[model samples]
Target: MTEYHGNVHVGGPVQTHELPQLMITKVAVGPMDNNAYLLRCRQTDEQVLIDAANEAGTLLRVIGSGGLARVITTHRHGDHWQALAEVVERTGATTVAGRYDAEGIDVPTDELLDDGDRIGVGQSTLEVIHLVGHTPGSIALLYDDPKGPPHLFTGDSLFPGGVGNTRGNAENFTSLINDVEAKLFARLPDETWVYPGHGADTTLGKERPSLPEWRARGW
Candidate 1:
């Protein structure tokens, strides 16, 4: 059974939820209300923060309380990459990002992950898949949960009602669609739960059948 541990709306801004055992905290940051996650292994207290935007203090506070181990970036967009350096310096944790967009983030990435690299946090090991198009070096985190359905952290690459915005010159809308259809939709089970960078949590089953619609709409 899935349990929600926290729903703290820091400063009446956005709702942040912490799911224990999983030790994951989802913080909504930035003017766009982007969600940055702080995940920790309950058993080991080793934590990881994904996507840093505004609220450097809040991010640091969450990490300090959770005992953060590292920070990981999904892409190089300013919304997700802005607070990365500060978080890294404050937490004293290594940063990891996709090889292609790594340079754009400007922080030194201790490890550059490719299509299929496994990263361990606490007891769970997450498999990283290169889901480019949103950015040349974007990656998605996939993990199999024994107690619950598997999860895919699609970064800015995939969302609840739609995929990520591909407005940048470096972004390819067509390639973004193709990557989601092939990498995300094809591999994971329809029941797999998705934790996107923005908006509400959704299941793969809810988003799959509408792929053609998303494609037709030109997202």
Candidate 2:
């Protein structure tokens, strides 16, 4: 709801300090202000970039500071992938995206990720969960640590107050709703933190209370 610099909207600044050991920093990009995340494994200095978008200059600044290892796309949205080639060219890091989105970027995704797949950055590992509603190959990244609240990075699928807009044949709103309710909501702990592609960062518990409202409103 809070728009910063035209495209970047933020409900709040990321709690990067909270995950100090992981050294995770999320940078907002594009006209929609999509988020591209930079995560560094504090112990080994390994890093990864997630969802590279319009803010290449800014993203590079963060990556340069932290040191980048790989680039990973969450879905096929042009806003999220357009600046990716630049990112790859600059960082020399391999790119990973869902098979469907990979072709659009013209880079053979070094790894085609699917549900239950794991992506590791130094010591921290992320679990890939495919939530195929907004796009056929849409995915979310789930990171749960013993010391901190679990985090879910939902790409263009689920947001703070609503779900992503389904503009293509690849989407089925009802099915997406079902998956969010039965799969994501049912499985994740109530205290889990959700950092969506756009809008604010919210908690599973905070958002779950309004599932019925969203369903009733036809989202």
Candidate 3:
């Protein structure tokens, strides 16, 4: 069993975590050091790629020959979809993105995701969460593992120290923080693992205590 810590860097080795029914592979790519995740079903081998964030060759190499069912762009951010067109073209995978930010994505989104939507990867299911502020249509994915801790793929919404950037807009910051608190912090447990779009992974418990500070700082 390969120990999966979820700590990845550009040009570093990929880390894959094995759950009872699912396999999660994480890699860091692109100049921005964007993190891309590959979720595979142990039973059916069906797979989904989260954020084909740059390095089409690297992403394709990670994807391999098994092929991809869908590519979910967490948000419309350019960095997150830098390799979208190429990945989709090569894999012929269905493109999925948030409803509001779908227009911002360069490629056509086959499916427009909304809050409470469910996506399937073979036997496992990922719940869609619409988080505003970072982007009007930014989204996060929650995979409640049956045998282990819940996993969350947060695009640019929730990070380790604070929520994603909202620029100088107070309203956007407020919306992002509020949604994160009510939807993520309040609803999920501390053991939930968070896989952010960039940087290292963090648990909800590690970031829970500082929620108040994040709100008070108002950045």
Candidate 4:
């Protein structure tokens, strides 16, 4: 049986937070307890939905009556996109995914993102960081917050306890750890917020010290 946090539920109240010019709304969905995020631009109200994981009706309601401008799939994982087709078809939102993972997804991708690509979210934008290993094209979105620490949408590339599963392969694990340390830990500050594809949120500061342990354990 899948365990879920107390806050994870259908029709759950959205957890909202302000990040400079962007407003983030997070909701947990699906049997796997995938987290779907709705990022709205404060200046223009243009919104983007990340990983419409499951429960299409709940996601549709979460977007409210305004609808969405684009739906971004974090990777090619089926669970991460169980609701993608429905949500996009219903809202007519443009679909975006990493260039390497686009062909694997069932939905047609409107935009192919690469590392250093900037996705405009009203006045602000999200920087794409393509992290390899768990999937060939797993990407994370970074938002630099002027008022506070930066925010990262890591998808399944990262989680609270450690990096996402690498199919128990040493090479894959090495690749993920290296990319995460170099691209994320080295580049971003410790206060950066990590919102993963599943489970509760965690901070880079909290997880940084455990890097060596994760390496030794070979997860």
What lDDT is obtained when candidate 1 is compared to the true structure?
0.78
**lDDT of the candidates, in the order given:** 0.78, 0.76, 0.96, 0.88
Best prediction by TM-score: 3
Ranking by lDDT: 3, 4, 1, 2
Local accuracy of candidate 2 as per-residue lDDT tens digits, 85-113? 88888888888887666666655688898
Tell me the alpha-carbon RMSD of every candidate. Answer: 2.9, 4.1, 0.7, 3.7
Q: Write the per-residue lDDT of candidate 1 for residues 80-195, one digit (tens) a residue.
A: 87788888877788889888988888778888988889888888788988876788999999877777678778888888788888875333878888888888888778888787
What's the count of clashing pairs in each model shown?
0, 0, 0, 0
Winning model by lDDT: 3
Query: What are the runs in model 4 whose C-alpha is more than 4 Å off?
Result: 1-7
Query: For every model shown, what is its TM-score relative to the native structure?
Result: 0.88, 0.87, 0.99, 0.94
- lDDT tens per residue, model 4, 41-158: 9989998999989999889988988779999999999998999999998999999999999998998999999999989877878899999989999999999987788999999998
lDDT (Cα, tens digit) per residue for candidate 3, span 67-151: 9999999998899999999999999999999999999999999999999999999999999999999999999999999888899
Task: Give model 4's TM-score versus the native structure.
Answer: 0.94
In candidate 3, residue 36 scores what lDDT?
98
Off by over 4 Å in 2: 1-15, 168-171
**Which is superior by lDDT, 1 or 4?**
4
